[model samples]
Target: MSEKVANTFDGRLIFLMLSILLNVFFNALTVSTNMGSAVWTASAVNLAHLFNLSLGNTLFLEGVIVAIVNLILLGQFDYFRLFRNLIFIVPYSYLLAWFKQLFFAMGIPFLPIGWRFVLDLVGLTGVAVAVSLYQRANVVLHPNDDLPFILRFRFLHGSPCWSQWDSNIPPIAIIVVTAILTHQLFAVNIGTILNFVMQGYIIGWADQHIFPQLHHHLDFKSTLH
Candidate 1:
């Protein structure tokens, strides 16, 4: 008998693919609320507002920055990797806009303050859970998430606080800085703070319980051999 080992390339790209749609969907839900959005989105959206660009345009540009950072971090430029990042991410930004339009056309409706708060949580949950699922797959990461994921592991290991922070410094810093900028412009609200406070905890929880199982399951011997 032979010991079973995990596959380096698991067949979970499908999960990643699904995560894209889920992410955009939740982004739409959050944005349409007028309550604010995830820190990342708040930053992007505020950037868009500043430059008079659409949120989609802001995301597209941000994705490019993320791709460039990924390349630099890898210490070399790979055409295939660059192509993969652009092909998927450029369109993903537009898809987020599309979903926003779709949801808008469908009418998200005017809700009371309490219900709006609830809606914000729902949107955040969808984004958090979607992020968790694809992160567990541990394959190709989306540019939006890649930087934080990379830095967290590189620097913040073994701290008692790591789990609550999993990807601590980068995201927290991003959220804080962006929160300041967006709030200064009055482009942010409680939704932004809540997501900033909660996302790390949710991702950490998912990493502890969800990631191990998905990794184990996806780690079966490579079927390509």
Candidate 2:
């Protein structure tokens, strides 16, 4: 292979490795938050179960309806991009299920209702850190990452300010909104607006701090030319 091509390949591999490591860390944090979310989902399911409703029926019907609505509103490209975020889903899902079952087996009590909010904040901070670092690396984005890009690019196509907000807003919004909605839907409250504020600042700070370091270390400009 040509020397230039070989170097390009090597650089990409390094970026991918970094991205994966960051993703793993992010997923680990998500499992923590998802534990609370799962409780919320379970509570919702249990409520349905109490009413003699089929679990499968709720999942199949609600899941499809939500998916269709999201697809129609978000567009095909954005909708399909959501699957890319699934990279961490399998492992996180397994870990969450196992943890939940283990807690149940041991007869552990649910987190004090107040503590669930703390867990949500902690999880959001972890996610922001992971995402900011990965994005600075400029590797291929995971499925979740694409959502912000698509939204920003589509709606704020002409605004420089929107461009800046585009990258940061989606991740923060997703984390905060998802946490809030999970609790609201299931009668479980986790965290407050402060969690979102702290996470967003941390992520923005990390992105600013890390990208410059990467540009210097990786000689990004030189590589591009």
**lDDT (Cα atoms) of all candidates against the true structure:** 0.65, 0.42
* Residue clash pairs of candidate 2: 84-143, 85-143, 117-191
Superposing every Cα of model 2 onto the true structure, what RMSD results?
Answer: 8.4
Task: Encode model 2's per-residue lDDT on 123-191: one tens digit a residue.
Answer: 555555555554444334443343333444466652323443544443344344644554433223343
The collision pairs in model 1 are none
Top-lDDT candidate index:
1
Model 1's TM-score against the true structure: 0.76
- TM-score of candidate 2 on Cα atoms, chains taken together: 0.45
lDDT, residue 163, model 2: 40
The estimated TM-scores of all candidates read: 0.76, 0.45
For every model in order, what is the number of clashing pairs? 0, 3
